[model samples]
Target: MRVVTMLHVEGELDQSRHAAIEHAVARAAGEVAGLRRSHLGRHYPGTVGGGQYTWDVLFDGRDPAALRQAPALLELVEEGALRLDTVAFERQHLSVPEPGIRDCVKRTLLLRVLPDTPPEAVERFERDMLGMPRYIDAIRNWAFSRADPELHPTPWTHVWEQEYRELRGLQEDYMLSPYHWGLVDGWYDPESPQRIVDTNLAHVYCPAATTILGWEA
Candidate 1:
């Protein structure tokens, strides 16, 4: 089973405290026997929502109990620097139902692109690239929206969220397949400009199971 834990921190956390927390987690990442990979990062400037810091940790284990034993993980930062006002964690167990095939699960990847050209040109380019036949199977559904001022400051940015059922070899296919050619062609527009913001990608593991940690009506 694979667990994806998302932690959101409220308020402005002290730098020293943040560093301490990161260090602790890094240590755990190295020592934990079941951890596969872990990522910790802060929200982009001008992002919406209250939580400014987010941490995503992935663990390959039978259950979440394996991660619960790491006491010193967040202790140092919690001592006097910051308090965890809110925490959102989720776990998804990985399974292969068939004899030779892995169970189909939902995985979402976020892509933030900044084109050197005009918004319309960029949109056209994306449509042409993603409209390719080879990519037709890889992309389940996608949406493009401008970064809201209340959500982010990146101008004319587009967010691509893609869902894949099976991605074992899709990464390579996406890089060298016909899809790449389409991207190159679309990027040839004269209006292409330098990107102002960094691109961020997050891998979220989705299973047949889910639980809501916090919600309000």
Candidate 2:
């Protein structure tokens, strides 16, 4: 299972403590049972629902032993130094496989689909999302999946993630794409009849020195 966690830091964490925090987290990652890979970094400029830092952990399975969070992270949360919003979802649809790029940007779209929306309409919305890469050449890789409520409950029902060569790929190619504005926009726009998603969403992206969303496992 792939666990994507976005944290809203309550205050400016002390610069002196930064290395300790990172080292603690890394140590925990190594000790954790099923954790295979992990990535932690500050989010980039273009963001919605607060800029926030992000943490991605890939687990071998849903075992309880593997799910334990780092002590440092728990301390921060317990001390009210950080706020968290996490989603655990399996990679369902993998379209546009990683283009073998080491330096890239990964963006995550976490949204809540209206519960009353017809299943057919929901399916159509998903199809529209998956079709975006076809029209936007800048998208290097992408993955879409429904969150597992049993594991972690949240208002967000789906996760749409994508990778790009740089911030421009998303700021320009993605935002300005005709298909994105013309067809896909309707599903999220309240004024449109096709609207099915709630306005509150977490659309954030950050720098990635190595593939996170593009990982095969």
Candidate 3:
């Protein structure tokens, strides 16, 4: 089981405080039970969502109740360093080729399931999306879950996360995968005129160096 927490920070960044914040987060990660790895970072240039920073924490496996009152986390909130925008599902992995996914290139999608869309359609979309890893060999990891907009400062209702070996694989292999174009594209295509999802808020991010087993030092 993998629990990912994405923290969207508010206010301007003080570059000097970055180290302090990260150190604090590391301390929190260590103190929290079931937390195996943690990564904190800001969006890359041109990334869609405007969050100044993101904290991706991977827990080994824990009940929601235990995670909710994590002491180090509460301390950060109490200290005013972070805000709660969205706390989506602790992702249940469907296809993970390996355990060291922290080093993979990651893409996070903030999905908006339309009001008029039928529940069955949403279910089918999720079913198809999860099936991608089976068809696209380049997709090393994939997970997603429904989101609660009220829990987030943003308007999205679903979050899609994926991992790949390289940027080119995201383009040449996964994008070109038959499962994507044949089944998934129509649900998001604007020209179709009845798109079920609003994809404007999605973005890609790589884990920072401080994250356990992340690509950086």
Error of 2 at 144 (Å): 0.6
Residue pairs clashing, model 3: 85-152
lDDT of 3 by residue, 65-92 (tens): 3443567667667777776444445444
Q: Which regions of candidate 1 fall more than 4 Å away from where they truly are? A: 1-116, 129-134, 151-156, 182-217
Local lDDT at 40 for model 3? 63
Model 2 weakest lDDT span, ten residues long: 63-72
Give the Cα error of residue 26 in candidate 1, in Å: 21
TM-score of each: 0.36, 0.91, 0.69
Q: Cα deviation in Å at residue 192, candidate 1?
A: 8.9
Check candidate 1 and list the clashing pairs. 1-94, 48-151, 116-192, 116-193, 117-191, 117-192, 117-193
Model 1, C-alpha of 86: deviation from truth (Å): 16
TM-score, model 2 to reference: 0.91
Q: Candidate 3: lDDT of 167?
A: 63
lDDT of 3: 0.62
Clashes of 2: 0
